[model samples]
Target: MAGLFANDSEQIDRRTSRSICDAVGERLQQSLRPEPRLPTHLEQLLDELKQRDRDSH
Candidate 1:
């Protein structure tokens, strides 16, 4: 009797692998595009603190 399962590593080609990777990457990029930008008030406060520290040192 022959076994029903076999290894499929030999059947995959470079082109197919690259195509799958590219599709998954595109989906991820689309999902991340709408993320909100950072808050400007927090950014300005951090910059001011850094400048004060630099002047003291």
Candidate 2:
């Protein structure tokens, strides 16, 4: 039945948003010229994650 296989709207929206974020992140990683240190990259990733958390609320 259509009901059994239908995707929830909210679920679809979340998946789309996640996929976009991942694609953008990948593009950024590929475009960066200087290879940053491990700690620097980790800190930036943490900051981006924190910003996303704040934006969601």
Candidate 3:
């Protein structure tokens, strides 16, 4: 009976630690995530380049 409780305690501790690590990893990912789109000035430059390409064609 004592051995069973010890095993259960270890499992619970492992699960708790894993959960905490997972939460911290998720928050770090959110904070470190890059923007998905270019800035406005870069977008305008790209658009102008695309127009020039189309005109050349």
Candidate 4:
């Protein structure tokens, strides 16, 4: 499996990759709208599921 992935020269440096990812993530966050709030009934159902989960544990 030697050389199966990016060779050393072809690989991106960690710092550069992190900065690039951060910029992209920031742009994505800016472009997306907040999701609509859940309906009351769905919220109640979610609360019930959470309670059942805690009870089981």
Cα-based TM-score, every candidate: 0.49, 0.37, 0.48, 0.45
| Ranking 3 against 4 by lDDT, winner | 4
For model 3, what is the error of residue 38's alpha carbon versus the real structure, in angstroms, after optimal superposition? Answer: 1.6
| TM-score quality measure for candidate 2 | 0.37
Model 2 weakest 10-residue run by lDDT: 4-13
TM-score of 3: 0.48
lDDT of 3 by residue, 1-57 (tens): 677767654566778889999999999999999979999999999999999999999
Alpha-carbon lDDT of model 2: 0.84
Task: Mark the regions of model 3 whose C-alpha exceeds 4 Å error after superposition.
Answer: 1-12, 39-41, 44-57
Better of 1 and 3 by TM-score: 1
Cα lDDT tens digits, model 1, 1-57, are: 134336565556889989999999999999889868669998899999999999999
Q: Name the lDDT value of residue 29 in candidate 2.
A: 84
lDDT of 4 by residue, 1-57 (tens): 677665787778899999999999999998896998999999999999999999999
Best by TM-score: 1
Q: Please identify which of the two predictions, 1 or 4, would achieve the higher lDDT against the true structure.
A: 4
Give residue 12's error in model 4 in angstroms: 34
Per-prediction count of colliding residue pairs?
0, 0, 0, 0
